[model samples]
Target: MEEAMDGGVRFSSLRFISDHVGFQGTIKTSPSDFIVVEIDEWGQLVNKALDEAVYETSKIEPEPCHSVKKPKLNIQNVSIEHESHGEASPAATRYADRDQDHEAGSENEGSVNGVTSECEKGSAGLLRSLLDEKTHTLLDRFASDVKGMWSSKTELTEPSLALSLGKVLDKKQRAALHSAVRQEFPFLITAGSNAEVVVKPSPEYKELCHLVSEEEALGFFKYLDARKENSKFTFKPDTNKDHRKAVHHFLNKKFGNLVETKSFPGRDHSAGNPNTAAITVRFREKARGKRSRLECERRKAVCTAFTLQKENLEMFEAISFLAVKLGVIPSDFSYAGLKDKKAITYQSMVVRKVTPGRLKNIEKEIMKKRMNVFNIRPVGDSLRLGQLKGNHFEIVIRNLKNQINDSASLRERILEAIENVKNKGFVNYYGPQRFGKGKKIQTDQIGLALLRNEMVKAIKLFLTPEDMDDPVNKAKKYFLQTEDAKGTLSLMPEFRVRERALLESLHRFGMTEEGCVQAWFSFPHSMRIFYTHAYSSRVWNEAASYRLEAYGTKVVKGDLICSDEDAGEHFPSSKVHLVTEEEESANTYTVHQVVLPVLGYNVQYPENKVGQWYHGVLSRDGLQASRFRVPALKLNVPGCYRHILKRPHNVSHRLVRPDPEVEVEGSHADDAMPSLSLSFDLDASCYATVCLREMMKGDI
Candidate 1:
């Protein structure tokens, strides 16, 4: 079999198992035309409706967890210099003005400790009307005590102020008393149960008192003590860029010349741009000279698993959107696999430190965006890639080339193809998607460039201008001709994030060789590895084709077979056994049991002609087995094995006449075209397109 060329890269010599002429049609006529439901490791379909009962029962209210403490101060002392009164007393005029402001803003200020301003105002009014003159006098004395404690210069302990409300019979009266105390002393943290209320200084208030007492101590820098090793903190990677900018601005404003904040690209390449970066705040070298310590207790990790159903959204974009909504970084989220971007997909995802209640609350919002989340519950472990049993696909192949008017012929043709697939299976080649779309330079080409240590060529492949007349291509063309990163960026759209990121790095650092290498590193780690993986897939496809042509369904000597015990594991190469001459003569292994290695430094080639063919193929491409280990790039292709063939499970098909009344985009319904609908389940990493290609005998 000869390789076919469609995209920039060749198909690398793939062969078909079925001998049928095959039918022609188009898949994904609409987003709903292709449906995918993930089958989890437990063999349960990840459907939102199926988990409704569990979701409803598992719903929990968010706990009152003050994970992020507000830096805003509720208590401040301002010295007023009155010409008539010379210098106004610190305790009298300041307290009186503060009390007036609190009363005036009681109905309009934002929420305090989850209590609405309306509730706070109403409760305060009720308390005022219910309390007697003697009670008011006692409250005033308590307020004075609180004021005196805050005014003192000595190191402050937690201020304790308690007043008995004399066993109020009405529950509403006791609630009103609690609100009144909160309104009068906003800095106090209050706790109420039954008829009693205990008031103490808030964490913010205590910190404020400490700052006032120790005027010599630097503000935020004191927390970053140089004596304490590993004292730095990194903000979550999924933190919004705007929010991060605001934090940087705030730090510069408050602790001017005392601290520095630096942003580094996040390790999680699975997230889209902006969310793909993280910020680190640290004390400046000059500020680190002072010796001070501040300690923070770490919160325990919580992983909440949920089923996310999305329509026409890429996995990284969806994760980034969810991360922004949930106020977490993309790295905090884990999923079993990446689903299709052009179809409706349901898959399980787990996010750390997020509660089920919080995820549940976002369902309506996510639904508005063509996505929904449900089946939310706390799981002990996080989901990893390839953790699922497989994916179930319900695909509609529409606009049949010749069978539009002949339902009987369409049915017969589909059944014949299905039977062939069931008996012999399709060639297990990496789908065209692995090579990327259109006539643009394929990912494998970029991988080859990287392997050869050609940094500039790899970048040029990424930024090369296609023949399209779009603004993005024009921007690339402009950069190539003029090398004006800033000018090119202005013409590019904001949504073209990867291109913009590269241009920005080039603009900042200039177009030196080191700058280009740095620009390459600007991409997420996963993206950097994807290029090499595609190259490996290219080699594997060619090797698989050669093996089938030479050995034709025979499990010969040196063939690697993974044991049944290792079959259940995600990556079973660790337990693979090589067939001996005796085993080959005895026919101990079947063709279905054989596996092929995706060329890598650590992988063992078969001790046969097929293995020798791998070297020939690599040598032709100017690569060797050892080149997979690129230490300079921090990339190591340790390699893995994949099954040489796959037969889809529970295959079924039907032919349907299009409804005259229903309108489907890109569908020939008015012509009464018959559509071929297929339902099948494939194991993890197997491309469904390859199965379709075997039946249709057309380029996918």
Candidate 2:
């Protein structure tokens, strides 16, 4: 009864549902075998955006929110001026000649009188480095306002640090600093009329301007004004760094204690007065938002929607990558279920409170790094997981050599297979993807080890060899065998940063059992949740499979059946009552619901053999009913119900015979295969491959 350490789902175990060898041949020979198109709650496909139309529509001005007022700053006449140490350097001319729109170099500039070729090259390199450093620093420090201020054609705000060199430095230092600024900062052009430098917007600024207009920006800020009243974040007027740091430290300590105690309003029966201690500090009074003149302008957010095209990228991975590239938090992005990595997928997602121009920058960056990844223009509202009704699939099953000679018989066989599925249905087992690939200990094993307080075992599984081909993994295996955490750090590649981080933690925390487990928890919350969920899902799968064999999709007199219209929100199994004879008669043949429990602290078994089977599965795994209640971690898996049967809608098919003339995009025309193009629609959390397996009649 022990789970397979190899992480392979034995198709033989699912024999109760159907025969394993119904048909023989593999699916997913290529990424094209599986295509996923997500459908929104309105029963419509989440379609691709027409790039040109999307761009044009994004440019249309939005109606302004009436609550906001304009500021009284004169930004129209701002211009940049450059002052020379002695004679102006060639860098000055280069800055002046930089194409306004493109931010590119011009060929019209002449060489400096005394500068050598080598010196020019060095200066140019230094300038490039300094410019990059300066740009990144500004971007990070003022992220919210960077899009608007940096790209404005009419405004040039004062630089955070002066570009001037004072008498405290020598002549050489001053000249070097002067040259660096002139080569970079395109804002510094010819001398201006004012005593101080007055920056003027150039063509470069205009090109990178905000996609959301000022009116829209103001509207969003006004909306935030209403949100701020009940917000967890309390804004304070900008203050000294030391004061802010101390306040942050205090709050962190207080919050940590609060979370550990689980103390909220009206739930304060703790022995110690933690709330009184926190209140005595009065940090909230000091940090509370004040009625500032520019309060609304300071915290504006613009939501943007875009169509993402990714080749073999997990939804979370793609979103995380984009967030890092855009210099934003991953929490800013919202998406539905994770997509398959080996398949091409297109889905809708939203980046909240970000300008379309910045979103465009992120898209451009992704294309540059990964030619396969792309994004259409951003448009409207924010997106969330499970906000959609389902997904539509356009799959191709290739190499069907078992077919009959006549087209009529071939068609009938396929239809019969489909019809069998329509009536008999298929068991909803969590696919192999939920566990992970290859013959090694799965994440669920590590999660189970963690739950059992077997920290050393969990760490070993993580560090031990998973992929032999990967040199870094090979090194990890060696170090794990030798029990040398410190030695592994140098061997770890940059791509294996997570492993390196773990090793570093092991070194710092002294390799104690608790320390190792704490180091595991240090990983991203999503990854930790993934490990726990994998284990919970394993238990659920076993229980469901057992119930299927016992019941055979038949409604017994004592059986609990979910209403077809309920959508499996509250599991019928949890609140079971004896089925009436009339109800059993109606459901016996046309039973549409099969509910299975996902194990958690609150989960209790049903009253009968089915319930005993659930408990037996838990016992075999060396887990108690309350094993999910791990207090050390914040992520207590509150498991829920899952539907054990799903059927597709809007089903159709087509046959594509091999031909040089008939070709699909991305696939080579000459390298064609005689394939069946199968299409269908299924609701959220349902796997298309599961449905396809029933129709294809075997291993896929």
Candidate 3:
């Protein structure tokens, strides 16, 4: 184990399933080579749903707030004074970020009330147009920046807005002045000479109020900031009302409860409508299937089936974008499994509680983008992972020359390869997609870091930007490489929202290993689960390969042999047979099960040759049976079993008609070569690429 850790190769190694193939060919030279059509649970293409099904609406629930201790203030070295200016000065001028330094005035020399630098509006005119364009501009800026301002040591600009502390006040007195400051900032109001007068700030001034704590500012900024940052990252809310409501809900939740005010929670208005005092705040109801199908059509969930024709989008990300556009969470939708990001895949998806009319609207919006990407309809029920009846694939193998020029001989070779795969099947190895895509630092590496209690290392792995050509990302990557969390965070773009959230957490919680781990957990729960599973899968794939090599197509005594049909059931609890001597002899040529262990705490291997191999593999990776039971991290991986063998069903093929135009740019049209098209179906958890590799019978 120690040696393996030192080597680093222990975690990076992966094994292929079909080490023994009889044919030699190539496949997938283009995105079109692989086509996946998801078959729904009812054994039909997931296309659309019936009109009778009702749409389910998710209720908003109040989330319990986690208590974060406030940082204590050091007032010993700070100086405070009381100054009474009988009359208020004019509002300060607005300047650009760079221009602020050149044009300066004495401290608090300008207006006690802030001015509207953009519109040149004073407190007098601002009150009249308070709900107009200027208010939105101020709110948007505050929403976009408050989160990043907490740990930020941004230089203080001259105070644009001030509060009238009736008498002289000390630093402690300033810190205590919270209520007026809090309520005033949201309304873009600043202190003025008159007791009730407040003004706007200069447009050029760029800084946070020193009087209030960063934690207090989070009250109004949390949800609004999230919305703004998400918008920048391409998550557009469904409507203006939804945007306001969501922000309001989060604010109330952040402050522990609704504030006692006339306009505490505002009401929802139509799209583009300005919010009134009574904002509508939504809290989720803790109820499952609250309404039956017969109760109300809109109350129950309508399982809408859809197909996505994607070129370059992750399944989760695509769903997130769609959900945001509709003012819903991605969790509101479900799918059987994730697909490749860089492929032209027509895969299945289902969303609950959305109306057909709403779907049509979503479709129109998608169409406006000029992309023929998504198609939607209604189904009776929502789709869950592994609820599908497996996937059917239509593939093309390209860039290979026929070794035999004779058509009959080439066809014979292809048939022989197919026959070999049909009898023996291919290994159900986890593909590269299971690990992190297009990166040297795989998910399993992060999992290992987690297991080792190296939270700092794990967090670093998460933030380590990929080696790419993006200039903005490159700059952020440089900061990350140097372990400069604040610097990287300051430069990080909105698209890197997850990373930004982590940095903010690190800044707030202190950058210790525990803090980093806690910050890491702040990410979406599904992602954390994915990271752990990737490591388990890597171990399973490597072990399966070794087991197959040791006992090739033979059932040894005490070997757990699962049936092909029962393979889909939980393998760990599935029925298995202890091959007796007579049964082994009788089924010598008919042996058909492969055991792939999903490493976890509850795993128990047979005391056979395969058991020894599993133990050896685990030890080499610095892993033990007990390490799988990490209850502290909530990662108790109860080991399971998976059948290593998978054979495609309803297999068929045909020659693809070559285009007469020879679209090869300069190639002669008459000399165009013919291509082959193969189609087949496999069970759930089986990769179509494995089947293609088996048919090709060569190195991929």
The per-prediction CA RMSD against the true structure, in angstroms, equals 22.3, 22.6, 24.5
lDDT of 2 by residue, 1-700 (tens): 3335444235436533544223333466676677787776556566654457545844433334223223211111122212122232323222222211111122211111211223234544654453356643542343334434554543543322122111212223333433333333322322221112212223322221242233322322221111222222222222234544444453344232111111122123254433321111111321222212123333245666666767655666676677777777666776665667777676777777677687776556787533233344444445544556778888877665453333444545665666666666666666667766454777677777767767777788878777577887777787777777777777787555567767888877857887786777556555656677778876766766667777776765544444443352322222333456676677642335556667766444455577777777678767785677565544555455666676777777786666676556777332354567778877777777667665665545
Best by TM-score: 1
For every model shown, the clashing-pair count is 1, 11, 27
Compared with the true structure, all predictions reach lDDT values of 0.65, 0.51, 0.50
Error of 2 at 530 (Å): 1.5
Superior candidate under lDDT, 1 versus 3: 1
Q: Which regions of candidate 1 deviate over 4 angstroms?
A: 1-9, 49-299, 323-329, 353-369, 401-408, 563-574, 631-633, 659-671
- Among the numbered candidates, top lDDT falls to 1
Worst lDDT run of 10 residues, candidate 2, spans: 277-286
Compared with the true structure, what per-residue lDDT tens digits does model 1 show for residues 182-267? 55555554443223344444444444344322221122222321112223444546446776676566545544344567777877
10 residues in a row with least lDDT, candidate 3: 93-102
TM-score of each: 0.61, 0.60, 0.57
